[model samples]
Target: MKTVLITGCSSGFGLETAGYFLKQGWKVIATMRTPREDLLPRSEHLRLLALDVTDAESIHHAVEAAGPIDALVNNAGIGLLSAIEGTSMDLARDIFNTNTFGTMALCKAFIPQFRQRKSGVIINVTSTVTLKPIPLLAVYTASKAAVNAFTESLALELAPFNIRVGLVLPGLAPSTDFGKNAASRMQNVFPEPYEAFAANFFANAKNTAVVTYAADVAHAVWQAVNDPSAPMRIPAGADAVALAAQSL
Candidate 1:
């Protein structure tokens, strides 16, 4: 059975994708900052490990413990919603630390193994905000956009070694914890005129229907891993598909 190592499997897309792979008869090494056995079924095919994507030491240890793997899913990310003027440099750096550097660190950890094996897959979970600009997401979008560019270039670099790289763009998934988490960390910088505009913008954005489910993201990851000819970018939600169509 092929083995896959996934990051941030405690909840959201990571958790869903881990469950999906286990059902498909694949051995799954699910890593999160906090490992929770109750979050997933107790199966021989599933192993939970602790991984802090932002820390190089933590990443090194987790990769070492994960052993040989067929695929690596860079799904761990944190989102932020704030205008550029409202966002502080420290806050922006923090988001990039998790959403950008974290993903790249995991890739660096596993690329040697994938290269040596000459057969492996890497699926990165990025946001559709990269394609379509939305208000109050400047930092978050910029971070994911970096990952999108990195994945595209890395795909070409690794293609000769048969190491496939794919990117999954998920749209606004209101049902997921991402929004709640982002809201909790949202900067309290809405002062004066910007506050009213920010409020209006967010309210309007939320009014739009949410068609993206966590399962849809997992399905995209599944296809990206199993399909040898999968495109570098895979849209994982209805809104994301529409946005991608606009780009086309």
Candidate 2:
């Protein structure tokens, strides 16, 4: 049985993806900041580990513990919603630390193994905001966009070794706790001049009918890891699919 290591399995897309992999009879090493065994079903194929993708030492330890794996899924990310004027440098760095650099760091840590093995797959979970710009999400969009570009270039860099790299761009998923997780950073983000615009944006977002779900992302990640012919970028929801089509 093939093994896969997935980050950010505490909840949301990572959690769903872990479950999907286990159902497919793959050994899964699910990592979170604080490992929780109760989140997933009891399965001999499942193992949980503690990981903080922002910290190099944590990555080292997790990689050591995970041993060899057939695929690596970089799905751990944080969200930020704020106007540029209100976004402080520290806050911007914090977003990049987890969403951008964290993904890169994990890839760097695992590339050597994948390269030596002459086989492995890497799937990064990004956001569709990178495809179509969204107001109040400049920092978040840029972070995910960087991963998209990085994945494309890295795919070419590793292709000679038969190592595959791909991206999964998910649309807005209101059912997840992304907005709530970002609430602290989003506080007072709307300056006086942009208050009306921010209010309207939230109102419209609440009423939007099309949105991504955790399962859609899980399915996309599965395909990216299992299908050698899968495209470099696979949008993972109805809304994301539409945005990707329009962009093309």
Top candidate, metric lDDT: 2
| Tens-place lDDT digits, model 2, residues 76-156 | 999998899989999999999999999999999999999999999999999999988789999999999999999999999
Residue pairs that clash (backbone atoms under 3 angstroms), model 2: none
What 10-residue stretch in candidate 1 is worst by lDDT?
184-193
Per-residue CA lDDT of model 1 for 1-248, tens digit only, reads: 99999998988999999999999999999999989889999999999999999999999899889999999999999988877887889989999999999999999999999999898999999989999878878889999999999999999999999999999999889888887877767747565669889878888877988568999999999999999878889999898889899988
Residue pairs in clash, model 1: none
TM-score for all models, in order of appearance: 0.97, 0.99
lDDT on C-alpha atoms for all candidate structures:
0.91, 0.95
RMSD of every prediction? 1.0, 0.7
- Candidate 2 global lDDT: 0.95
Among these predictions, the greatest TM-score belongs to 2
Deviating ranges (above 4 Å) for candidate 1: none
